[model samples]
Target: MWNKLFVDHPRTVQESYGEHAVMAASFGGRMVLAGLACLVHAVVPGLFVRTGSRTITVLYDEMVVNRNRKANKAAGEVAAVGGR
Candidate 1:
């Protein structure tokens, strides 16, 4: 149960527990800042015109695109080895 709660997901993502924790925390912090910026923009009308969108784009690239790339690469390697 502990491994399932703490280790499995991190291992699947090729990260240690500590590494995953730090990465998740960093992303969470960035999201909070982006949300604040968007809130400010909503009231001010001009500031942070691109901040929210830019943050989403960056986070998507980091979290989705890169993760898919890594998973695909690992899968390909396993397939190659199995084929040999």
Candidate 2:
């Protein structure tokens, strides 16, 4: 149960438990801030017009692009070691 709760997803993501926790918290914090900005922009319609979308795009790139790079690197390293 402990492994299921803490270890499995992080391993799939190539992060340790603590690293995953910290990263998840950071993503949540950023999303909350972006949501607040979106709320304000809905009423003001001029301020922070780009903040929410920009944040989402940046986060998506970070999560998808960077993670794929990491996974590919890891796979390459494993293949090299196995070939050796």
Candidate 3:
């Protein structure tokens, strides 16, 4: 199932650099590394799923109020500075 999600592509720009065996090899390596990263990203979410009802709603609401207060203070300070 997971194998179908990963689609690999070759590095085409490297081929234009030089007509040499080493360049092609490095291009292939880059493609492999990119493919590996994509595969890891796809599978990682399933592996690290936090299974539970989130109970931080009140805390988040408090944080929003705190953030608003701080923003208002900063804006007031900016206005005072500009006024002077």
Candidate 4:
């Protein structure tokens, strides 16, 4: 139950429990900051016109690319082991 609660999801993402915690927290922080920027930009159109949108784009790209990278890495490891 503990493993299922904490470790399984992180392992599936190719991260340890602590690593996943830190990374997820980092993403959440960035999202919060971006949301704040967006709220401010809503009121003040001239300021931070691109900051929030750019952050969203960057965060999304990072997630997709990282997922692909982890998948490719795992596949390569599997192939290497099978070849030997």
Candidate 5:
């Protein structure tokens, strides 16, 4: 049960438990900071004009693009071995 609840998703993403925890925490922290920047920008137009969007782009690249690339590479490796 514990493995299913905690390890499965992390392993699927090619990260160990600690690594996944750190990555998730980092993403959460960045998102919170970005949200705060957006809130401030909402009140004051001059401040943080591009901070929120930039943060979103960076996070997307790190979390989605990189993860997809890793998954694809692993899949390709498995396919190559299977085909051989």
Candidate 6:
């Protein structure tokens, strides 16, 4: 996202933030989200913060999905062919 801003007229390191309030807000929101994610991880193992404490195991049926190697290999092959 920050790459979009400096694609042409790159901002001076010492004076960039002074000219861009939206960039400052974007960075602030990103930091807050990261901090919150860390806090959630500390309290819940394998629980996704964005998914509201939902266990990854439950979300993807990891108990069954992760165990079948043939299924995983097939999925990978499909993804490679599909250009995903």
lDDT (C-alpha, whole model) for all candidates:
0.94, 0.94, 0.49, 0.93, 0.94, 0.54
Tens-place lDDT per residue, model 4, 1-84, is 999999899998999999899989999999999899989999999988998889989999998998999999999999999999
lDDT by residue (1-84, candidate 5, tens digit) is 999999999998998999999999999999999999999999999999999999999999888886898889999999999999
Candidate 2 per-residue lDDT, tens place, 1-84, comes to 999998999999899999899989999999999999999999999999899999999999889986998799999999999999
Pairs clashing within candidate 2: none
lDDT of model 6, residue 26: 56
Rank ordering of all candidates by TM-score, starting from the highest:
2, 4, 5, 1, 6, 3
User: How high is the lDDT of residue 31 in model 6?
Assistant: 58
Q: Once model 5 is optimally superposed onto the true structure by TM-score, how far is the C-alpha of residue 24 displaced, in angstroms? A: 0.8
Superposed Cα deviation of residue 82, candidate 3 (Å) = 0.3
Q: TM per model?
A: 0.79, 0.91, 0.35, 0.89, 0.80, 0.35
Clashing pairs in 5: none
Residues 5-69 of candidate 1: C-alpha lDDT, one tens digit per residue: 99999998888999899989999999999999999999997999999999999998899976888
**Model 6 collision count:** 0
Model 4's number of clashes is 0
In candidate 1, how many Å is residue 73 off? 3.6
